[model samples]
Structure formats: structure tokens, C-alpha cells
Target: MTPLHQQICQACMPDSSPVMDDQRASLMSQLPGWQCLLQDNIWQLKKSYRFSNYSQAMAFANQVAELAEQMRHHPALLIEWGRVDVYWWTHCIANLHYNDFIMAAKTDQLNVNSG
Candidate 1:
């Protein structure tokens, strides 16, 4: 199977089901330092990347924004001094989807490529 980072996201329908427990566990294994959690009653994939300065963190966030645009999947981002937090979830479904995992893996690659 293709790695999640190299996989393209698919458009999700409103009725589409969220990621299954078994699949979620498998996907989460592929991502290190990432958390799959429930926040505000929504399941999301989240991670935080650390940088030496605010500029680096902002740059990383920008890179993620560009990637989101390319994939047509957006994430909630919080940029702060020396750190950037990314949250990936399907807004329409308000749950975790395979696309969120794909974006999370790709987001991890962004950090790797940046540093």
C-alpha cells in the first residue's frame, strides 16, 4: 500500500462514516508523536512541531497551509513562539477520517522536509 503521506485525499460525503477503530489504530501506528483524541466532541488527529524560533514555526505553518491548499483539505493550526500545533479532522462530518490521517502524515513530512 502507498504511504499515507503520498496518498491523496478523497472528497467525503456528509453520510460517510468515520474511520474504523482497527484502521485508526493501524494509521496511528504510522505516525509518531501524533495524538488521536476527542476534543469538543470531535475526533481529530493532532501534533505539534517545535522550532528554534517564531519565524521557523510560522514558516512551517505556511508550508502546511500550502499543502492543505494543494490537497484541498484544511486543518486547524495554532502557531506560537517555537511551536506549531496542527489539528486535522473533517469539518462536515465532525469526525476523524482517512483523509485526516493522510494530511497528518503529509504534515509530518512537511516538518521533516523543512528541517
Candidate 2:
């Protein structure tokens, strides 16, 4: 994975706390690759994208890494045989920050073209 500092887009942090409904809508619209899974206090975005082979999976991983680096946001990426799983969270807030989900959404957007 690329470095966190390089992946973050520090300038675009939304100014308001998106209402719950808005948050969900944003997630739905922007992050198609990620499935919303609510944990204790965090919103996790996960998905498994198929690949033709190991190299394709590795390419996707590299793509995600680049995006993460550019956004200065990082997701835990688990690379299995032919798929990758990503876990996203914001530790600073102790719960899911709106930005975390936003980044998740954007990352999904990035993956759309990669596939």
C-alpha cells in the first residue's frame, strides 16, 4: 500500500456533519464497490472483486494503493488468491468520520475504472 500522507486529499473535507440519511445516500451513490457493514461504532466498506489471475489482483491492489496514497487515506487491504478485501476506519474520532466513508466512496469510484 502507498503511504497514508500521500493518499489524503486534505482540502476537500466536508464542512458539515452530513445527516445520517445523506451519509447513506452518499455512500450508495459514490461507493458501489464497497458494501456497508456497520460495526460497533464504525461504518466499514468491503467488497471482493474478481480477477483473472494473481497479477490482476495485484494490479487492483496497486491501483487502490495509488488512490489511497493520493487521498492520504488508508484502508486495510487484504489480498487473497483472486480477490482483495478492504477495511476502512478513522481512528482519530473513535468512530467513523464522514471523511472515512467519503474516501471509501471515492476509492470505490477509482476501482470502477480499474476493473
Candidate 3:
């Protein structure tokens, strides 16, 4: 299978189903330091990225924002002094979708390229 980061996100329909458990597990394995959790009854993929200082964190957040804009898929980003928490989910589907995995992988790639 192609790496999630290499995959492009497609528009998700409101009636589309969430990714299956086995598929979720397989995709999750490709993203290190990422955690899957149920928040407010919704499953989201989350990760905390550490940086040296606020400026660095902000820079990372900007990069993520640019990527999100490019893909037209956004994440919940919590920027802090030295860390940024990112959460990925498909709002239209009210659940996790393949796009979440792809974005998560792209986020990881951004982190790698930034540093």
C-alpha cells in the first residue's frame, strides 16, 4: 500500500462510514507518537509536537495550517510555549476517515522536514 503521506485526501460524504477497526489499526501503525482517542464521543487522531520555544511551535503550526489549507482538511491545533497539540478527524462524517490518517502522516512529514 502507498504510504499515507503520499496519498491524497478525497471529499468525504456526510453518509460515509468511518474507517473500520482493522484498517484504522493498520494506518495508525504508520504514524509514530500519534494516539487514537475518543473525545466527546468522537474518535480523533492526536499528537503533541515538541519544540524549543514558542516561535518554533508557532512556525510548526503555520506549516500545518498551510498543509491543511492545501488539502482542504483542517485539524484542531493547540499551540503553546513549546508544544503544539494537533487533532485530526472528519467533521462531515462525524468520525475518523482515511483523510485523517493521511493528514496525520503529512503532519509527521512536516515535522521531519522542519527539523
Model 3, 53-111: lDDT tens digits are: 99999999999999999999999999999999999999998799999999999999999
Error of 1 at 65 (Å): 0.3
Residue-pair clashes per candidate, as listed? 0, 9, 0
List per-prediction Cα lDDT, in the order shown. Answer: 0.95, 0.65, 0.96
- Model 2 pairs whose backbones collide: 6-69, 7-68, 7-69, 7-70, 7-71, 7-72, 8-71, 8-72, 9-71
TM-score of each: 0.98, 0.67, 0.98
Most accurate candidate by lDDT: 3
Could you give candidate 2's per-residue lDDT for residues 1-115 as a string of tens digits? 4432224444334443432756666545555556777777666666777777788788888888887786677788888778877777654444455556666656666566776
Better of 1 and 2 by TM-score: 1
By TM-score rank, best first, the candidates go 3, 1, 2
Tens digits of per-residue lDDT, candidate 1, 3-111, equal 9999999989889899989999999999999999999999999998999999999999999999999999999999999999999999989999899999999999999
lDDT, candidate 3, at 54: 100
